[model samples]
Target: MSRHPRLAAVAIATAALAVLAAGPVSAGEPTVSDPRIVAHFDFDAGQTPENIALEPDGSADLTFAFAHQVARVTRAGATTVLATLPAVANPQTPNIGAAITTGIARAHDGTLYVGYATGTAENGIWRIAPDGGAPEQIAQLPADAFPNGLALDERCGTLYTADSARGVVWRVPLDGDAPAVWATGAALRPTAALPFGANGLKIHDGAVWVSNTARGTLLRVPFAEDRTAGPIETRATGLEGVDDFAFTGHGDTVLAALNTPNKLELVRHDGTHKTVLTAADGLDNPTSVAVRAKTVHVPSAAYFDTTAPDPNLLLARISRNKL
Candidate 1:
């Protein structure tokens, strides 16, 4: 999340301006150059790519928002459609009118878990089979609950999610009952509603690392500690719209996606930070990031544009050593 609370305010105002502006500007074909940017593939014009989950075998599982699609992209960059979401059953559904994939994670056994928000009235978790099967709802939340980011503790078979609407992190057992609040506070609330907005989440080394979108900082919450501990400490600041992140190698380093500036940042546990790549680096509206084998991969999708070209989805590759 961008540490500046004013960015969210500006975003809200910009959203209104965007609506008034109407049509979207044409974006050119994405290209990669010296900095090691690799434009893997593009999605359908209206498909808004969100989070990306890498398969153990090197393929990628991608989520699309307005297009209502989840696709599997092979290491060769071939995209295979997995599923399409159905319309909401209720009329008064909060954010349920549209099914958007806000979070995605893979379990130890290879099953995929996706978190989505619909119409504002319904939010829930869905399980996807590795071999490609229908997504099944495993848990559901109230109208006001909007689940955003997801992470899995493969060793313990536990899943963690940042419930932005409710201002809490929920812990869900893979095969057990529904999820419960594992952490909560004003700091984790949505950007529009809190001084600090919680957008990205990752569980590493027994601690939860969260991106405070509004406050423009990375916060750490020790496992099993009370909220009074005040999120251990802030990781980094001065970032513009840090939304989602991923750990490299053994979790010693992090790669974050900056939404507003459309950049990717590399942050070390020691507090050192550097902009690895930016919009100038060929990324536009990058919402989430993932790293594998020292290679930083980011998904660029038009989040606010309703009529942007569908194939605008791009997977950008950056060398980790450059960071």
Candidate 2:
């Protein structure tokens, strides 16, 4: 918007592009084989980035963990903090990061429905006006439940959230009725080894697909015409710490951000999957991904696993020219 902001965006993009020319990938990983880096950003480092929501205009609204804020990033790489969540002090928890703002979904009219870990229904989900006015509470959730990923079906007049703590999925009616547990099964709960069960939620085709971070698996449940959930079926496996993903808008292909291994995977509807990009190519704890045509936007939450709290936000052009 302003000269300084534009220049900052240019500088961040330039630095990322420079890395592609510098070498095959960053140190300590295999060389990038298939998809390569197109653009990246080390923006607002030290603040953990979580989920990203894409705007029709090619911009992305990203949620953070510690900063408790939502930032809008443009195609040109410029960024603006759209909203700051209410202060949530959760010293009793292992890390307050888990209790901060997480999932964010924007309505067609620009109303943004955001999720936070306030542990109170009145404070859990807040709808922020497009003009960025005070947030309005809309739904309630478990005090121990951690709602991380949000998916909105405006046509269905419902919003869905994935509770990572217990591997439960809550469906909230837009009409403001009490939230209902639309889907919850063994697939939704966390395993002993992997304590975080469901992480990301997405509605595609005829089902609501969910990613399990602990089990490193992806599962989906069929949704009937009346929004009834069917059986849970495994979609893909071997994605440990699979945080968030976005449809490539190309057939059944989807791009997923792998957190632990620091990779971007291309998974198809046929159950076939492949590693398209690696951290050696500059990905670091990528928490989530958003797509626009051939361009893929990934945010590295850079959790404690990373030396820094905030890593870089990555932009890459995949081999397949799809969103």
Candidate 3:
């Protein structure tokens, strides 16, 4: 059995999605002149990174998708265990090793937020102090909500997470309120064959953009001045397994990590335009991306081309040049 029960389902669709190549685009971030490998997974402390958050001081915090652990990697590539989250197991199907992502996000002040579940229940979000210690539960979620990707809206002092299983975007105020559904629509729902929907989310330029992993769509929902949600707009369509993405720090372009086909793609604000960096350039199952000092850092989950979990994790970097 694969680590994720859904991987079998992912296999069914991968063959189809993998072949839909992205055409060239002129408007977005320029292709990397040099793509380099910075860190290789030692697989000693943690395994399978689902997301990456970079600290201002150049350290990186990552979530182990199946291991249920939180770790930090320094610029020099040393790993440190921050906390081991409570295991989430399905009481009925205990033997299956599902890689449920406990989404990790870091605030500007260096604090971290994580989300996890014990199978169907005991699901919620946690706040870890800057110094890193035992996690304090911030809010519990619905029994069915599998929180995957997390984003912090600093202006509202709120934390938002993507519920991949239920196609919901949930929110919890930092000041103390129960986690509640922030936004949901047909766009967030998953396709029948592949399971993930509303996989990654971010608060950028007064709008929240979410990627529908199964449906392969990048969606946008405007955040009103009062923090209310506007209508959902299909910013980009036919994105094959679009996962986590980061602002390129150049004009209105972003670098998105595509999982199934194993590549990094540069996307424009219109979402219709794109250019990609493929396996020939050395990317494997890139889960998410973060930008700092004009550099794009990505963490590869290395989840594909094998039934058993792969221990080889990789961190790669790309330097963006101007148009």
Candidate 4:
């Protein structure tokens, strides 16, 4: 389940309608097409997909949020459990209620790196090889920290994790070095109303781009020539409840998941954005998004879905039109 407090369903539905009604649709703007549910998960059994990473073969690797397991779903809707995380003696997680496996990233060699927030000694990042077995903890994050979004920069041999509770990003070296604080500031901090911050992490255009769920902003931390942190920049704003995002092949244009309202937005490079997908299109609190060539993948956890609880993955083709 998501860490943020759930808003009333009526409120979310109303907000979703407002956005959809105002969303712009014109020539040269990218819109979602052929949106369909590729996989339906057992929401009652804790199989909520919190994040996703795409495989080269059109399959998707997902972190089942409450199940504490990683699984793969093929294009034909076949499912396979890749690895199951160990159960914590005490399942109580800080800020959030229970332990969960959140963000995920797949390496070139088919290895999977995932964030596990057990709120116990086991809290950290875990790695699973291609020939999956037991996952090994590569980095031990703070027990109280909630590691949510993850991104891999194979160029720097680093794995960046967004700590939602700490409002900071951790730089975990793939070469076994200790994980250290990568970036933090006011923009990353949470609020009294929203408890989560730094919800998504991605390395794009030589910079680390992150979304702040509480602050409703997307920030950019450019890397210096020496690979140090450059001045922080706010790329987009007014994106409350935004979770994970992926860049379209068109430069810095992005497809971002707006969780609570069950919507997805096409965010342009100039900070302007418009809703492109909505609840009517089968989004049940979409948690993350991934773009693989012309394909867009969105996984809905349905954390706030009480009416007809159905946690599923939706796939759609990204319109070739340049935005």
Candidate 5:
């Protein structure tokens, strides 16, 4: 999902637009502290951790994209494979070009839901039990849909997914019903040059927030009382190559991962942002971010980095006052 040369082309085209959108909403510089590599994964083995879900005990569940595996990384730097999806015979998947596992969400009962983009019949959401066993396909999405970012709305008993190639948000009910399109608009679609659309998703404050990787913007879609989508709003822009993001537990503020730029930024409620971490802090194209209390969890897939690529989990302490 993260490209190097292609991303360079996108930067040339969108740089001026990003500067205009950036405006005067700068929140200063890096404020997060004590950033360190908590877990190291094998980059050559395709163990690129794409997304992360933090457990209550401080461990993290991740989707190893190219490896077709779901793993858990502990606070003490231990890694365990939780589930392995069936490998597709063909590697050249539609749109994004690989059969990989993208997003993951952990339910209250320890059920792990993940999005698999295989461009095949098994391209859907798979459920992994807490005890660990063969994963079950709970919802079958379209083969052409590249479901990337996933979020669980426990209150509504539903799961929301971002279709990176289709520019649509899909809603999957947990009651054995069917999955349906939740939202779609120009804002979620990708351009011809920039291939990825909706790259991240989250349910927060009675709304669903998503990042448009191609458009370099963050959008908010409110849920009506009946659980239908309200009007869409663009919360922030200029986040070129933004992948996945997490809230810092401070109202609507956010911590976003810039995939191509290899940086993490603290986005304020006023639409301004500032860099918090970079390659020097052990980020190799960070794909997603997760926050639990004061600890911040970030997984770098190293999808674009060619020289000295290191796919690992980087942890940092969230600044109580700065973030």
Candidate 6:
């Protein structure tokens, strides 16, 4: 999702700690009440945590392309490797150069859908059986078309992919069919397709909410029925390098990872937005955010030195009294 300008700059500087302190804290900043560090994983020894997917069983699956493996971190804090991806089919082509899995989602049937960008021309979708088998490529995307984000509409059995290169949203039917362009345009292409760009996505109610990193905007498009809608409705803007987001337990409140300042933001579905946490709140290069129960889990990745220590990705519990 490097298309966004703001995120491109952040990606260049992997020192997540430095970026978070670049700005000052203000009273208007999003309030993170009773924030505490619930869990911490040190990637300094080479466990680069990329994206996180939570299972119904309360286990957190952390994916890392550096290790070509997915680690299951149980709610009890024990970590285990769930699976390892195979080498790219072709190593010479830029499209299929390296097998870098970026996004992941689990279907209602327990099928795991993983999206990866082969350094070569071959980027596509893959499915891993619930019982755990080899990942099978389901669809091959176009050359230079990197699939960066994945969101599943379980009710409709539809999968959405954010094609950062083409600045388009793609829909793939779970029943196995050709993928179609669900949405496209310059507005969709917030930046060049870098971090925090169009990297976060989710389908809620009858619409798709996308985080526009370059413009620092969150966009909402009408559901499948309004696939041909003229333009997306701007839900919120002025955010700083907004990356991935997850809905709160109530589904109406959202917590977003702000990449630039390394903060977590809380956005109300009704259009109210606030910075809930800042550098003081202990987030570093907060790339993705997910909420389970009352806990907001954030994953901070250090992009510069793959060997540098990854920050203690915080899991803050939302105060029941505040909301």
Give all candidates' CA lDDT scores. 0.63, 0.69, 0.71, 0.84, 0.85, 0.64
What are the per-residue Cα lDDT tens digits for candidate 1 across 68-157?
577777655567788765556652323234456778898767788888677443467888886767787787766666667788887767
Clashing pairs in 3: 88-118
Candidate 6's TM-score: 0.80
* Candidate topping lDDT: 5
Model 2 C-alpha lDDT per residue in residues 1-323, reported as the tens digit of each score: 11111111221222211111011222222211334433244435325677888889988787866566787877676778888876655422211323467788889999898888655443367788889977777887767777778989999889999887768888988898988888989888875554567888888898888987766677888997777889899877766567788887766566778776677877766555667777676676787877776667888765534243335567776543322
Model 4: which residue pairs collide?
A: none
* lDDT for model 3: 0.71
For model 5, residues 249-273, the per-residue Cα lDDT tens digits are 8788899998878889777777777
lDDT: worst 10-residue window of model 1: 17-26
TM value for model 1: 0.78
After superposition, the stretches of candidate 6 with alpha carbons farther than 4 Å from their true spots are: 1-46, 89-99, 119-122, 192-196, 224-230, 270-272, 304-308, 321-323
- How far residue 70's Cα lies from its native spot in candidate 3, in Å, is 1.2
Kindly report the root-mean-square deviation of model 2 from the true structure over all alpha carbons: 9.2
Q: Where is the poorest 10-residue window by lDDT in model 3?
A: 91-100
**Residue 205 lDDT (model 4):** 91
Candidate 1 accuracy as lDDT: 0.63
The TM-score of candidate 3 is 0.88
Residue 127 error, candidate 3, Å:
1.6
lDDT of 2 at 203: 86
Superposition error at 116 for model 4 (Å): 0.4
Question: Candidate 2 at 282: error in angstroms?
Answer: 1.9
Model 1 segments beyond 4 Å from truth? 1-45, 89-97, 119-122, 191-196, 225-232, 305-323
lDDT of 1 at 287: 74
